[model samples]
Target: MNISLAQKARQNRIAALEYLRRTKQGAEAEGEVLNFFAHRAREKAKPVFFSVRARMDDERIAA
Candidate 1:
């Protein structure tokens, strides 16, 4: 299925929020993020992964 750019962005934002929530609660988001990265890495590799992380970090800092 093809996802629109807006849909993908929404999904990424949801995932990032969940990650931030987990980390703030002293929960382990490392494995979840790593698993997500590993799966995406097979398709688009490192750059996408880093970009996602960067966006997430940026959002975190802004909040």
Candidate 2:
């Protein structure tokens, strides 16, 4: 269940490539498709700040 950021990014890249293949756009817009997916992957890979705050609150409640 716990997937690393690098793994997620790789999966996204693979998905993008598969999408291109399925749509027959691999030869024409491969770069654009990859770039878009890479950008989204980076966004998804960002550290979630609110989770840390929520964890702290939960700890306080448990204590």
Candidate 3:
């Protein structure tokens, strides 16, 4: 399925917010600043990760 530019941007923003949550700053989740931070990371060459932890957790889940 094809997504619009705004929708894709929103997805990026959410991915960023999740990254911040899993990283050393999980306590501070503000809706406003997530997109800016995410874009900054993107500019530095980081892909948008939707659920990295979830993917890794499959090991335990399978067991």
Q: Kindly report which residue pairs in candidate 3 clash with one another.
A: none
Q: Write the per-residue lDDT of candidate 2 for residues 1-63, one digit (tens) a residue.
A: 999999999999999989878766754555444467767887786675768889999999999
Please count the clashing residue pairs in each candidate, in the order shown: 0, 0, 0
Tens digits of lDDT, candidate 3, 16-63: 988867763543543334467776776786567768888779877998
**Backbone clash tally (model 1):** 0
Weakest 10 consecutive residues of candidate 3 by summed lDDT: 24-33
Q: Which residue pairs in candidate 2 have backbone atoms (N, alpha carbon, C) closer than 3 angstroms, thus clashing?
A: none
User: Candidate 1, clashing residue pairs?
Assistant: none
TM-score of each: 0.42, 0.38, 0.37
Runs with alpha carbons beyond 4 Å of true place in candidate 3: 25-63
lDDT of 2: 0.79
Shift of residue 11 alpha carbon in model 1, Å: 0.1
Q: Pick the candidate with the highest TM-score.
A: 1
Q: Which tens-of-lDDT digit does each residue in 1-63 have in candidate 1?
A: 999999999999999999878785663534334356766877684553467889899999999
The candidates, ranked best first by lDDT, are 2, 1, 3
lDDT of 2 at 16: 96
**Residue 42 lDDT (model 3):** 64
